[model samples]
Target: MTKTVQLLQEQFRHLRMTEVANELPVLLRNAEKMSWTYQEILQEILTYELKRREEKNVEKRLKWARFPYYKTLNEFNIEEQAALSTRQLNQLRELNWLDQQYNIILLGPPGAGKTFLAIGLGIDAIQRGYKVVFSTMGELVQLLKTEEYIQKSKVQLKRLREADLVIIDDLMYMAMDQREANLFFYLINHLYEQSSIIITSNKGPEQWVELMGDQGITTAILDRLLHRVEVIQLNENDSWRLKHRSTIFN
Candidate 1:
């Protein structure tokens, strides 16, 4: 065992356990018996430390403060949902999109991976060091209902407009009433040119009017969102849900 390894392992031992100091000599012998070079051993320790720091950072980001929670991409956990083709994923990679100011609409039936894909994209953006806000339509409306503003409702509007990537999950789940529809329009208009938006909805563009129950508001929202966005229509698979394999965590 090298003197440096002995010293470092002893230090780690003292920090971990009192009797750990005695185990360091044996630990170093095993590490040496593996024929690891000094550089390789140092790199292994560094890698472990780096991974610890990364896990902490991921935890912080998952907290509600660093990234405000409307919903969680991690909660969606659609690791087996094969919605996109390899060609499309390659195109998305080549484009490096999600950074650009473009709207993305995922239109499909329930359990068709719309919300899963949208949350996946949001997770991707967060890992890539971009700010993101994810909220469902019902949750967003409830927020608006509770927040009372005397002058103008600018704070929420500003957050929506300034976010690097905003995700609105379950877009047309409930038909927005008069006031909610107006507020929704205000948000869509504000985010039109400034930032990117991703929306997951069961209703397609053609069925939006019926879902919203207002022709004017539906047209206004769709005109802005669809103008610069690409609509991905997910095919309805009858047995896809049953056949999908989900991993159970310990």
Candidate 2:
């Protein structure tokens, strides 16, 4: 029996069914105990291999996403955000707009759940088999600046360009010179119409010119980004972080 099992495992591995090879013993045992038919045994083996492949694919995509943290849409507190309603949030989760390559701009003060919402949507997208990438504006700029000289930057930017949804956090948080603004514009141009974007920022598009420091570049960037976009303004009330801060004494 052991020799037979080993031979079967070796054959499965040679056929590139590594997952099935590893689980062959357990599956064989279950099949024997349950008296599964030949057809049932074949179905079980194919299903198990496909399921394991999907699980591994999801894991690979999540790692490629490089999210600061994993937070699902269900974890979001809709009650805390007056700007967005439950129905609207559900609509976003449906991802119809994402499928149409529409952009989403999340505007609000610090800790207004802009980043949290963006991250949540990104995670949801990943689960749905969409390629997603997360990068702060600062990190994106750095990546753009060094992409030519740094192999790591090149790889990261390649992933960004291939992503279905790109989330840029804290956009226009600092002023950028001509070169930086130009680099940023080229990236947006490449992604324009080909992919959707979710931008989280304290300042709106109207205020982006001030930080970009170049009217022409800012206008060009806005032209592509606002072409098919939804702007959601979050609440201006007390910071969500402050309201939910953990007390040391407690």
Candidate 3:
């Protein structure tokens, strides 16, 4: 029986069924003790392996998303934000908007949970089997400004194109020069209808005109983005960071 098990392990490795190969022996013993039939044992083993594979895929997708930190809708305390509508929050959670390539723009004061919501939705999208990428406005511009400008930009842009969702956090946090504005326009243009974007900004659309400093570029970027967008304004009374600041001491 030992030799037979060893041979089966070698065959399982060749078949790339590592999870089953490792866990089957213990499960088989449990099955015997439980008086499980052959078909029942086989079903349980397959179910276990399939579940592990699904979890592994979710982990891989989350890693590729490049989220600075992890957050979830459960972590968001909706009760505190009286201004936000429960219906709208539920709609966003449904993820149907992403299927239609609609953009989600979150405008609010600093630390009002815009970034948290964006990251949470991104993590949700990954779990639902959609590819996602997260980048800050400054990081994206720096990527475009690298030494191998053309080649590097191409590779980075391709990454965005391949994703089902692209999250741009802190969209108007820093001043944007003409070059940065132009680069941003180009990126937005490519992703226009091809993929969904989630933008978290401290400034609203009206404020972006002065933020970009170029009307043409600003208009162009907004035109494509706002065409099929859901504008969410998070108007909580106080910053979540400030409210939760004392929790660490507790």
Candidate 4:
């Protein structure tokens, strides 16, 4: 409420230090109460601003990612999913593969944790300051087809192109026509070596050609995806969703 405090806040706003500006009053009160030195106060303000900015950046990236749901690696039942060990999960979290632009292919049947795992990795990547985008195979195809004409689609595709990692869920869930197959291939080609990819699919690579309906297109797609990729097959006998489904009577 003091004139000096108001002036300081205005200066911070002018410098685009909005986070510090808003918290300046509280910070000053804490400093006074603690009898903090000038250096300590300055360090605290800078740390707070940096932390808030990182959090906001994560939020923005998460919005752009467009995950169907939020899930963390911690929530994944490692015991239930026998394929990926805790050590493997920890390694994945290190994100060295992502930094090296390596791709990940998660294969499993319906209700398996493939999608969940992909989303968890994507979330972790975002928190670590990487841009990520998530779209189902069907949604990606539609977006690619419409990008030329639709403004929203263009925006979405732009984000996808600029992302450090892209997650495509339910790949080859259905057969694609010649045109659809071509579009998908082109997108994959564009992202090849430029960004890491995480793909979740119920079908294996051998089965992908059948769904694509074009051996040549499938071959080209596979070439880029398999060039530097880690394939993990989730072979859990029971579906995680089915096991956790709530019953009305219960």
Q: Rate the local accuracy (lDDT) of all candidates.
A: 0.67, 0.95, 0.86, 0.94
TM-score of each: 0.64, 0.97, 0.91, 0.98
lDDT of 1: 0.67
lDDT (Cα) of model 3: 0.86
Candidate 3 C-alpha RMSD relative to the actual structure: 2.3
Model 2 residue 36 distance off true place after TM-score fit, in angstroms = 1.5
| Cand. 4 Cα-lDDT | 0.94
Q: For all the candidates, what are their Cα RMSDs to the real structure?
A: 7.8, 1.1, 2.3, 0.9
For all candidates, the clash counts are 0, 0, 0, 0
lDDT of 3 by residue, 108-204 (tens): 8987989898998998898899999999988887876662657856666677779999999988878788987887888799999989999999888
> Worst lDDT window (10 residues) for model 3?
144-153
* Residue 64, candidate 4: alpha-carbon lDDT: 96
Model 4, range 58-171, lDDT digits (tens) per residue?
Answer: 999999999999999989888888898999999999999999999999998989889999999999999999999999988998898899999999999999999999999999
User: Candidate 3, TM-score vs. the true structure?
Assistant: 0.91
Candidate 2 residue-wise lDDT, 1-250, digit = tens: 5999999999999999999999999999999999999999999999999999889988999999999988787988899999999999999999999999999999999999999999999988988999999999999999999999999999999999999999999996778989999999999999999999999999999999998998899999999999999999999885888888899885
lDDT measured at residue 168 in model 2 versus the true structure, 0 to 100? 96
